[model samples]
Target: MSFDDFYHAHFRGLVVQLRAYTGDVAQAQDLVQEAFCRVFARWDQVSRYDDPLAWTRRVAWNLAHNRWRRLRTARAWLLRQREAHVAGPGPDRVALEAALAVLPARQRRAVILHYLADLSIAEIAAQEQVAEGTVKSWLHRARAALAAALRDTTEEAQDA
Candidate 1:
């Protein structure tokens, strides 16, 4: 088959497969287009192969994988750079930390475990060597104290 005929026959199917694999239509189209360009460059030999479509499909998939790997590396580098540029915690976090400090030690530990650390009540109970009910009570009381403290801070700011 002519290169033009071969491309027309397989381009959409290849694009669809690449799109499903890559989750990006534009990227899929570009990969498929580049794959066809490569195949056309060597069509004299490729057209004689047992399965030109398979060869084209494999080329497109390889292009997609290479692109994904490059993007993943770039994203990791960006995230590391972003970590360095991150700003310090703001006033609300400061106020919340101060409010947390005023909680009794056990209550503070329980609150930090259950909420900040995302531990379950039963897990906190096991960690703290206390009953689940005690952890629950500490969480309830700590939440109330934090609410009251933050509210007071907000009120003081308004008054000032």
Candidate 2:
């Protein structure tokens, strides 16, 4: 069968199967689309397979599994970060978040990974896919900016 014909015949069923595997309709759809892209990339070989739809389903399920693993890791990391901080959102927490918001994106990320997430410089470097020195520089700049902002806030409050 032609690739387009196979896709048209199997897309919805593959999406339904992936949704059962992932328990998320949108993620299932995304995984199925990604699987189709892969299949399209190797249409010559994939179309020749005895069961192209089976191959697509396998790929989609694998993708869904990988996504689930990544999400689990992220959720665990978030839980750890929450445990590192106090239980409730207090004024100080609000002020600190406001200060963090003023930094550039990279700097803010560095600060969060280092201070809030409690990741080591090496860990942050790996996660950011940059050199350790670059992570250090970002953290240093973030700290300076945060200190200045918080100091200004403090001074303003005192004046009030």
Best candidate (score: lDDT): 1
**In candidate 2, how many Å is residue 68 off?**
0.3
- True-structure lDDT of candidate 1: 0.93
lDDT per residue for candidate 2 within 114-153, as digits (tens), equals 9889999999999999999999999888889999999988
In model 1, the Cα lDDT at residue 155 comes to 95
Using Cα atoms with residue i matched to residue i, what is each candidate's TM-score against the true structure? 0.53, 0.52
What TM-score, to 2 decimals, does candidate 1 have?
A: 0.53
Report residue 32 deviation for candidate 1 (angstroms).
0.1
What lDDT does the true structure give each of the candidates?
0.93, 0.91
**Can you write out model 1's per-residue Cα lDDT over 1-160, one digit (the tens) per residue?**
8998898888999989999998889999999999999998989998999999989898989999999999999999888777457589998999999999999999999998878899999999999999999999999999999999999999998999
Q: Whole-model lDDT for model 2 versus the true structure?
A: 0.91
Lowest-scoring 10 consecutive residues by lDDT in candidate 2? Answer: 83-92
